[model samples]
Target: MAERIFKYVVLGGGIAGGYAAREFAKQGVKPGELAIISNEAVAPYERPTLSKGYLLPDSPPRLPGFHVCVGSGGERLLPEWYVEKGIELILKTEIVKADLTSKTLTSAAGETFKYQILIIATGSNVIKLSDFGAQGADSKNILYLRDIVDADLLVETIKQKKNGKVVIVGGGYIGLELSAAINLNNLDVTMVYPEPWCMPRLFTAGIAAFYEGYYANKGIKIIKGTVAVAFTADSNGEVKDVKLKDGRTLEADIVVVGVGGRPLTALFKGQVEEEKGGIKTDAFFQTSVSGVYAVGDVATFPMKIYDELRRVEHVDHARKSAEHAVKAIFASELGETIDAYDYLPYFYSRSFNLSWQFYGDNVGDTVLFGDNNPASDKPKFGSYWIKDGKVVGVFLEGGTAEENKAIANVARIQPSVESSDALAKAGLSFACKI
Candidate 1:
């Protein structure tokens, strides 16, 4: 058979690939000129929803509703959008071999395709307990959430294990969010993490205190200073309990692991430079090799704000970097230039009717602001990170639109703070003024 050809091909059909394809379409696309290779059966939808509203039984967002661009508050790009734009979407296909030198990709079935330009957006893979040689790690009902299929499995398992005991292994966003989802389902939930506080990467102790306490009030058990070392399975090959590193065991009808993730960059190994465990790229998301780019969780690019190389694994970067990569491709073709991506790192999570938004880096001395009493009827809290005598980051819980926007602006501007105490005293008002 003849080899398939495309002017441009985007690998990995998650948020990054979807957004990149949208950008390509926006610029212009002739029939069969562009294609998106995704292992997912459906077109790209907001992946974060897998843990949030998608878990809700009532009116959960299904496919086509939460497609790409919707997360950016722009026009949703459904599967039909691809057809309308004359863009080919190769779904349920996995490229087993990639040859950067020849600009060729071979599918798992041995079909070959060639591209003039390529964008890599494979994202990441969940770090499984199996990687650590945990006993009974492959037991049934022990789940993870990374893609729609995983979410579907979790939802199905929730029904089969309704009102059951759930042991959440890890206290990051995945564990925290899933805790709420399972708890709301009336399942008994226990969270175990080996960190001093939850979200140690972003939330300071003071910041984490509010959430930990809030979760406590929600009737979820919190176990810190330890991790799930092994799992116990029942006669039916379903997870029955979790053994902790601290020599404690807890009954678990369902186990969900969210320890962390490793960037998916094995396919392009040795083809391009790698750093920070991700494919190295410039501010424009162009990889070390010309006509090839990497984005999303797999792209480690320069952060001009911090004057360092950083690889961010959040949805915001996933969407922005994809757009940037496509824009950079179009620019190169048209002999035009655009400003580099100056991203102010942002992350957020929502659980149990409580939401938080954070902006900029979470480094330096953190100052807590607002009341953090989980018992309070109206709980509102935030934190600011002051680094180099400037407010480098802002975190606010239960912020309104204008209020959230204020914190974002503060993070982007990084206003100087005379002192941590003074900044704490200024609080939300200080951010509002900015």
Candidate 2:
């Protein structure tokens, strides 16, 4: 009698899928026994740098050049890693359908794979502004940046324009970063947001207001509480202006729509349970079907802080969640139950010469800690969200190594009246006083 080898099939080669595949290899899974199917022709690569480094005009002109360079060996997350790890790499392959009851997946190439385990890590796709009719009005000037291809096209378009005025249509992290980069390139930039402050969904009103002044001082116009109704273009078919809901029109050359993105789960539609644009998964990241798991932006699970189920799309969430999913799979194979995944969510962004970091969940009743400077003259201070005397979240500006570590430690412990007093004694100021 010989040990039976199990087959594992993973779909999507983005961060979640790529890391999952690598983790499987490290778990002693042989190459022939595991297979990675992706529609992308190239192997997995880092996407965070796409909007910053890879999108710059000085970057190499080809797609391959966008691939990150690693040590002296110049090693990247190339497909050869799959071969070396004994994993089968199926590039330029799309999974069209999956028969969950039979544990079978059908690819666009007309090949079927039956696996004992399946992982779906399909990332997300940018929500196009065309859906809102803003596309037809200035089809030539409106652009969306999601992947390397989108960045490349945008770089080329920017290079051809003179006296370029770029209007970014969102106030999220990506949009803010893009705005900063465009301003750094010395182009006229304006950001339009439907909310009263930027990143309101991620941070508190106090923190969001802080960034408004931070960006305004950097020569980037912040059009808060305004929305674009339509794009007005010149007869030559180039974007000339943007008409806002306020009956005002502003000049623009390029309109970069960074409104947000939706998870790429169309292939799993009707086959898996989804809520609010992500697959509904258990604490272990298992879907409704047996042996099928989902992670990253496409999966939603319970959050300890909010005491509700939520989907997080940050890089840290994806990496941490996928690691939990892998461990659960390993445990289940041995007929053992694993503990539920419970880790605090963390995220950070760098823009306009400021580094912002947040830990824990920023939801629920919060009492801010630190200075509240609306004038934006001094360096912005950090704020901690207090709930029932425990610090649930911390948001800070100007990345001080000591302050960040202190915030991290405070976030892990329950804040009591005594602990709060201790923090104040430890030199953490209250927002109301400042």
Which candidate ranks first by lDDT, i.e. highest? Answer: 1
Q: After superposing candidate 1, which stretches have Cα over 4 Å from the reference?
A: none
Which consecutive 10 residues in model 1 have the weakest lDDT in total? Answer: 56-65
Go through the candidates in order and give each one's C-alpha lDDT: 0.91, 0.74
For model 2, the run of ten residues with the poorest summed lDDT: 65-74
Per-residue CA lDDT of model 1 for 219-280, tens digit only, reads 99999999898898989999998999999999999999999899999999999999999999
Q: Each candidate's TM vs. the true structure?
A: 0.98, 0.87
Question: How well is each residue in 1-434 modelled by candidate 2, as lDDT tens digits?
Answer: 22223388777777676677667766788658888777877776666766666554454335444332331123455666778888877778878887888787777767777889888888888887676766455458688887666776787777777458999989998889898877877789999989878888777787777777667878889887888888777887788788888888888989898888999888778988998779999898999888899999999887765677889898777767776888889888889887898867777887655787788767555545455464555565666666776667777776576767666666666454445555544445432222
Assess candidate 2 and give its lDDT.
0.74
